[model samples]
Target: MPITLPNGITAIELADDYPALQIETADCSATLALNGAHLTHWQPSHTAHPVIYLSPTAILQQGKAIRGGVPLCWPWFNAHPTDPDSHPSHGVARIERWDLISATVEDGSAIIELELKASPVIEAHVPFPFQLKALFNLGQTCSIVLETTNLAKENIAVGGALHSYFSLSHIDNATVTGLQHTPYLDTAARPEKSAVQTEGELRFQAETDRIYYGSDLPARIHDAEWKRSIVVEKAGSLTSVVWNPWIEKAASLGDLPDADYQRFLCIEAANARHDTRILAPGSTHRLETRFIVENLS
Candidate 1:
């Protein structure tokens, strides 16, 4: 029998392949994949375009990372900074399936909680006992909270990100604000140069990859073509990242179409690089981000 959730939400199998929970409310609708606790679709009422983007050619199989829509990069971000030959790049959380703990509706919003515990496979990669909990609130706005607790006897260092891909009408027409005057590492530059952003707003014209340090303020993506603004606010994070594969690099990604770069932009909230968290045994750390969409006149 299919699982039943509060507020008339339904648990259904997607393509007869993976189990997923469907959330519907007066203001929005969403789909949460059981594997990785991935949220693949979210559409607020009265919006023409989805706030979150899922790649057209994304693989949804077990033990694979879906190309878009807020993939959780836990324990580590990107490749292992110390190990050049680390496999699978961004940690093991996104590939491991998560268990749904509870689902409920409160104040007209659908709230879902999922959990992941360390196993033999996870311990082999991370070598630390840990438990992860993800809480998602879907309404007119989307809020996500990720909490990690160190279950090991010793302190553990952890770094990760909420890799969010947002839909856009055109990449060139969008301007991201609130990161001005921040120092960032330009990873696309040869040898990875560090620089301070002088521009009042960031506009995309080429392949970009930058990790902004000490950025705790909310970032806003204003899309002129779409006549909308997406504001991303966060807590318990000190670093933020912005990335886009413009032309040549986009063509090289197997899960993403070559021309799909024009339709989305990624503004990730992270604790990566020098901001890695050192959690004491039995201590818990939480990273949270909220997304709100506003219509432009």
Candidate 2:
């Protein structure tokens, strides 16, 4: 029988039949789908395409854009230009399948918990053998929770992040505020420079790629043309990443349209290189990020 959770949420039990899970919230207003127990689609509003969608049903990675969707990429942020064994551009978890344990729907949202036990497939590529639990909560205010437990006898080195691709009407008319006087590594220029201080809000004048480190301030993106601003609050993770491919790099992504990059920006919470964290046996760590869409008009 299908289990009916709180807040008008329901979970279909198909663990023995197939690798699909469905989560529905109260009022039957919103629904999120999972394949192989990993988040696939987060549809907030019924009259739309979707708020979040992950491509390749099995991989749980590679999110393709549609409308106002936010793609969730985990474990790693961007390419480690210096390291090759870091596991793909981000990490191995994105491509691996996760197993669902339970779910709860409450307060106009649904929270589904998924777990992954280390296996030969993951161990072959990733040296660390650890247990991972990803709690994905879908609602009007959605959040994907990531928790890692060190199960291996030896201490392990791990790096992780949540990459959120926000949809915007226009990039030129948007300004990001919050990070002030924060230090960041500017990846746009050659020789790779770092900023000790920022003049003001970071604006997308051209192709921008910078990783801001050690900031607890909340950041916001104001879309002047759309009359809407998105506020982001971070907990557990201290670093913030802002990226816009602009013109040049956007053209290289064959899956993206020529004008797509101008309409979206990636504000990610990441840990890389020097910021990487390690976990010892019987230890655990967590990272969380929240997005609130508010009306500016």
Candidate 3:
């Protein structure tokens, strides 16, 4: 059976694998996978390429993390810093399904909300009581707001990222701007090294994994070959992670095509490292980011 929202958004199971919501507006269309409340695709009517990228062989199984789009990393990131081997990487949010709360259309845009609360599956791992909600405003630009509320009486530590994979005409033709003069941890370096970015624009040549600190500015992806640029803006985040699996790493991944790394870049809005939040009981923290594609010519 198909589920229809009051604003005519359609919810249907995809490939008998997982439930997804479809949103169409006068300006754009998007697909949201409920398993992670993940925004898988977004395309403005005027753009030639999609603003987001989804891997061709991405796994859509119920408890598996889809390989692309925006995967929500929450509660903790990458792994628990103190107990790396004891916790799941990127937390529990991306592997669980979220409930659609509402979907509405206004002024040629689609506004949607999805919610997730702590359950037995989640408690079995961390045992922290919390409520997570995501609000999406999709149109010519796509914006998302993730709010996490602590339900327990004590304070809770949390960190996360909107692990966004953006499409590019070619990795060599893309450069990310706005992180100039920022300091970052080079994760690809042996034992990890800290460095300052002196280059005004960051270009890709090899495997890249750097966590930039204290970044509150909007970053821009200039795709010279595509003649377009993608502007990424964010709030409530003090860190930005830039990554690309360049060759050997990409080949080892089962879900992503080896050569697919040449077509996308991951510039994420994150609250990791020294910026992790400690939420007081009854308090809420919202992490938001917006993506807008513009023609260069």
Candidate 4:
């Protein structure tokens, strides 16, 4: 039987790639892959530029993480904490298939929910057993709700991030506002560097990677080239990750183009570092991020 989607929403299969959903509405248009429930494209009709950044050289094949857009990093983040030598980067969520639970259009916005159940592959990555559910609301703004539930009998710790790659008119034209006065760990440094507080809005010059601690405040990306700003708001998250691969790192990534570093900025909403949560059996934790694009002109 075919799944019936609400008005302006259609189920789509990506040729030889993953099965996904195509959302079209009066205010915006977007594409979401069921593989990881990854949101690859989202562009509002009023804006000339895309809201999400996708790599031109990204390989859309199976079992590989897509190079851009919003990739979910769950269970664990970055490299494996203890098994970094052998485990995968960012866990197995991005490479797994998710089932569509429901789809409905509410008050002009399209809300789609999807679920990822535990499996042998997920079990192989983490010691604890758990499940995940994600909800996407596409409208004047984009909101993602991620809920994680613990299934084991004992308490377990977890951390991860939304890991959003936002499109930019040009890398130099973007500066992130907020996260100032908050402590952060610079991950790009050799031994890693720690700062007591971020001074002001962040600007790009070189490769940047920092994990901010204890900040739940909203952040905004001021895009001078496009004459617009993107507001990032989060709930149930304490850590913020701001990163830019710059020239050298971008060149080394097979999925990202050499000079393409000039095109995007990643300011993630996360639960990482000291903010990792401990969940008891039968308990569920929710993390959400809301993105709004404002035209400056």
Best by lDDT: 3
Off by over 4 Å in 4: none
Global Cα lDDT for candidate 3: 0.89
Candidate 2, TM-score vs. the true structure? 0.80
Candidate 1 regions off by >4 Å?
A: 1-3
Candidate 2 residue lDDT tens string, 67-158: 22333344455563346564465655655555656777667677778776666756755666677777766776667667877878988766
* Better model by TM-score: candidate 2 vs candidate 4: 4
| Count of clashing residue pairs in every prediction | 0, 2, 0, 0
Candidate 2 deviant stretches above 4 angstroms: 1-75, 80-86
- Tens-digit per-residue lDDT, 159-194, candidate 1: 999888999998988999999999999999999999
lDDT over C-alpha atoms for residue 137 of model 4:
94
Tens-place lDDT digits, model 4, residues 177-252: 8887998898999999998565687888999999988888699998998999889999889999998999999989
Q: In angstroms, how far off is 206's CA in candidate 3?
A: 0.7
Please give each candidate's TM-score: 0.96, 0.80, 0.96, 0.96
Model 2, 153: alpha-carbon shift in Å? 1.8
- For residue 174, model 1's alpha carbon misses the true position, in angstroms, by 0.7
In candidate 1 the C-alpha lDDT for residue 239 amounts to 91
Q: What is the C-alpha RMSD of each candidate to the true structure, in Å?
A: 1.5, 4.6, 1.6, 1.3
lDDT of 2 at 19: 42
Cα lDDT over the full model 2 = 0.62
